[model samples]
Target: MISELVMVPTDEAVLTGDLVVPGHVPAVVLFAHGSGSSRLSVRNRAAAAELHKAGLGTLLLDLLSEREEREDAATARHRFDIPLLSRRLVAALEWLAQEPNTRDLPAGLFGASTGAAAALMAAAERPERVYAVVSRGGRPDLAGDAIERVAAPVLLIVGGSDEAVLGLNREAAERLSAPHEIHVVPGATHLFPEPGALEEVAEVAGRWFLAHLKERRGPGGRRA
Candidate 1:
């Protein structure tokens, strides 16, 4: 696997990112990090590293501006700014779609917290481009009415100890029309705080991406 720190040239300054290209490149994962966290989030970076080893590429980008992060941290709305963050995720997706390394390849999303909502919103906005989504202890309710508009499969991974959040993910899962599943990590906290729990997340995520990110033709798995 080859990893590099890069930038996605966008209208809103340059979106900083980490690119990890695996040997086979079965799919590309666009990550949306949780609140107050940057692309350097250790948990997400760990998952991305495993995905890379499993022949999957990943682009982890900052979902908020430095100024926005500071303000949002002060008000705690930066992580909850569903609309603004979702739009940014969509822009990053479109930008990735135009990149030579990821263009024409199946794409997946790995989102945590409100970032999950942003990922879901982007999937709804660009159904044809996103093949799958994986949410880790995310607040999918922030996606609002976009849930039904999403055409790809979604996997919601919640921590068992995070009972309240798990319930929310269950409700969100019910509203998703596409193929979906909810997996609970027993004894883990909201952030999968338990030891070795994040490793489980990485394995589950690898399987999901491998299963769905393959060449899906159409409704009947036909090549359009």
Candidate 2:
């Protein structure tokens, strides 16, 4: 595997990330962390490790710059700014397309909490480039109208005990015209802190990304 720290330049800011590409992988999953989170989120890193074992690359980045994170932390301003987050994700997608090491592989998005909304918005804005998306305990409903425009297959994974978020996912699923599925981890909570819950998430997500991103196809074997 090739692992490196990289900087992704956006129109507004330069974001930092860790890029890990396992040899001969079919796709890379870009991680969008939720509010108050960053590239170093433990759960996301753990999930990325699982993806590596499955022959997939991963890009985990801080959507906000250091200054922005600090400011947001103080004022609680930027974390819920979905449009800003989406723009950052879209910028990262563009960067991936031009980056020498990752240009040949298809791309996927793995988002948690509010990051899922940003992922969906980015998928809508760059339909041809993003092959698939997976949401872990996400609030995809916050994508607003962009939720209806996303063309890639999506997998929405929610904890069985996270009732409010699960209901939101189901409601969002209705607005999505693209192929999607809701997978509930039995007896798990928002962060999947249960004994085996997170492992189940990583396994299911790995399978979903492999299925859709490997072939750039939707459900029923149709090209996306």
lDDT of 1 at 95: 80
**Top TM-score model:** 2
Write the residue-wise lDDT of candidate 1 on 104-173 in tens digits. Answer: 6778999999899999999999898898999999999889999989988999999999999999999998
Tell me how many clashing residue pairs each candidate has: 1, 0
Distance from true location, Cα of 172 in model 2, Å: 0.5
lDDT of 2: 0.94
Worst 10 residues of 2 by lDDT: 215-224
TM-score of 1: 0.92
Per-candidate Cα lDDT values, in order, are: 0.86, 0.94
lDDT of 1 at 3: 75
Query: Which residue pairs show backbone clashes in model 1?
Result: 217-222
lDDT of 2 by residue, 43-122 (tens): 99999999999999999999999999999999989989999999999999989999988887789999999999999999
Q: Which window of 10 residues has the lowest lDDT sum in candidate 1?
A: 215-224
Q: Estimate each model's TM-score.
A: 0.92, 0.96
